[model samples]
Target: MNNLEKWFHSNLGVLRRISQIGALVLVVLIPILNKNEIYILLGNFYSLSIGNLEIADPAIVAQTILLTKKVFLPLLLAGLIPIVITLFLGKVFCSWACPYFLISEMGAKLRSIFKTPQPSLKNPKPQYYWFIFAGVMLFAIISGVPIITYFSFPGLISSNIANLVLCGIVGVELFFIFVILLSEMVFDSRFWCKYFCPVGAVLSLFLSKNTLKIKLNSVACGNCEKLSESPCINACVLNLNPKKENLYPYCNHCFACVDSCQNYGNALTITFQNKEK
Candidate 1:
């Protein structure tokens, strides 16, 4: 009933993207602005601190834990922070903070413009790839490599950005991201994120059946009979049926479904602590 773009523009999901883009910007600025270690609050991808608060990627912790079998309180807390947040907020970090998401979203958009053909998954269970990632990390940890740092997409992008600016050292990790970009452009666009991030998989282990989630009002959803298809499912990057309760760990909490709903039935809403919107 209104300009489609305007309708899309009116949702709260834009705030999510803004925060993600903002974090990406800060990664760039941190290395550029802080030449002297005067600021202790700033940090890179695997770990970050704001004043006394430290947040670390739990996958890094897992790698270290597997290697050392001992938990250092400070680093343990650093890693647990993100995991704990995931437990309460769903995988908000993937949708709202990862730098790789912006690039992948652009690639996905471009692929859509070209009508890029993607093969349907034989096993639609998205977390299968996450397990593959976890297995690799586990093997690497056992092999004494702690290789998640060397191979993680976000870790690489965050590491390289910090290295290139801070130490003037460029590594091969950028090439890895380029290859992933090409993959998204030519094939399954949301493949890596939808199915495979080890760090995301690690964080997902903390998600519970009822932890902050999307709720569907079946009556309102069913009454919207004029639609060509289910917008909630179509809007999902991870190919999830947002109207269902069985959302897997792959959900990034991107809220694209909410944005796509606009003035429609509005049956799908994110619920915090079992409270209805």
Candidate 2:
């Protein structure tokens, strides 16, 4: 591995640990801080809102919209960063900063206890496209329907927590939340991240030739079939075999395969361009 790859592998464990703790704190604290007031706000926002266009946190959107309209400097910088990152780093934000990824990682770790086999990508199908198509149709028909926003885990969690606080009773939503949490604790988190998350669906469209990609060295992987064990495939949480051509679009560039290659000869490197054959 190159210096940059080595550095990322070395530091990623620490980063994941920190992110997990931070996410837990955010989930627990948000409800405590708002108490019942958050529910009141959400209920009002959901009721009067036009055509499923509920703003779970109007304060956040209002602030961002205001900043974009009034303060050009900050909004410009904020907008530029994601565009630059998408062009250069691809979906590093999804792999690194997204809380859902942390939850998935936690699920992967939990799965280790049962020696749960890595999921297989053989005959893998793209399920996210259907959701994307549905979202588009709903938005086109309903005009103001933010259908994609409804299923967003972050938004759902926040709204549900507020609703629970306001109602003074944890209802069916709580049951669903528990099931999600329990499932994550038992299986790989990426199952939901890959199949569901509209944000991930949106980000996949922006990934281009300039984005960072995981490239496999065919020379080192020539005997993959002959080998009794597959280290890289074994390490992949998304069940992708790097030896395969044209990887699935759901890949978040998590670098688990890079960490799994003990021989170093299987040069599955992350780079801006495909490696020279």
Candidate 3:
């Protein structure tokens, strides 16, 4: 009969945020270390090789398959690892590691802090850009080079950060990244992640049935008040409803609701075990 407040009260969200921020800081150093012969922690964006090992984005795998029509061993291994992780962990990379998510989050939080009125309440679906994503990959195949790394905000920012730290070539992607943030600042803050990012959608596609999920205890709690400022609704980074059914594939597993419910209401919980029984 232990409540979620007593069962779990630690701020795992803060730890998760810290780890993502640290990973972003490391991205800048990766190229610098390689250039200076100091150390090679990893490579950039799609191509992340650690020491002697290699790992790449699965999109890169798709691009390779499209372009060369042959599986390259190193790149295959690189791509497979992340795809495998996505199957078990869902779209965790979006929440836990993507540097661009952190940037988007900071913008959203600032908007919330400023009490700025959202331009509209209509949520966007990353699926809206599915055709555009397909077009980009088709371009990669036609050009015989992965152009996704160039347009991907996370990839673009990381590359620019690394290059800027090493030399002074500021990437044009920096301007595009700011345009994205400005749009989020003014309208549809969670729109990109919810409806536009092909990367998040790709990872979401591989989610296993037993992937960890939140469990809202109805026995110990009452229905949410239909309020514009409900704690669970406000706490969601993606602006999703915890009380709503079928929240998976979009939760991002941030556990912010667990924290919010602990402070404001004790009805919500996160558990690996299914709560259906």
Best by TM-score: 1
**TM-score of each model, paired residue for residue:** 0.86, 0.64, 0.83
Q: Between the candidate structures 2 and 3, which one is better when assessed by TM-score?
A: 3
After superposing candidate 1, which stretches have Cα over 4 Å from the reference?
Answer: 1-10, 116-123, 126-130, 223-228, 244-246, 273-277
Q: Compute the lDDT for candidate 2.
A: 0.56
Give the Cα lDDT of each candidate: 0.74, 0.56, 0.71
Per-residue lDDT tens digits for candidate 1, residues 1-277, read 3565455445557777789889888888877767766575578787887778888889888888788888888998898788878888888888888988878887887888889443232225644756687678768866888777676677678878988889899887788778978987776777788776777778778887667777776666763553326665667766566765446666787878777765677666666657554
Better of 1 and 2 by TM-score: 1
RMSD of 3: 3.4
Best candidate, lDDT-wise?
1
Candidate 2: give its CA RMSD in angstroms. Answer: 7.9
Where model 2 places Cα greater than 4 Å from the true spot, the runs are: 1-5, 9-83, 121-123, 126-144, 155-175, 181-189, 222-228, 262-266
- Cα displacement (angstroms), candidate 3, residue 173, comes to 1.6
Q: Which prediction has more favorable lDDT, 2 or 3?
A: 3
Clashing pairs in 3: 55-78, 56-78, 125-195, 126-194, 126-195, 126-196
For every model in order, what is the number of clashing pairs? 0, 1, 6
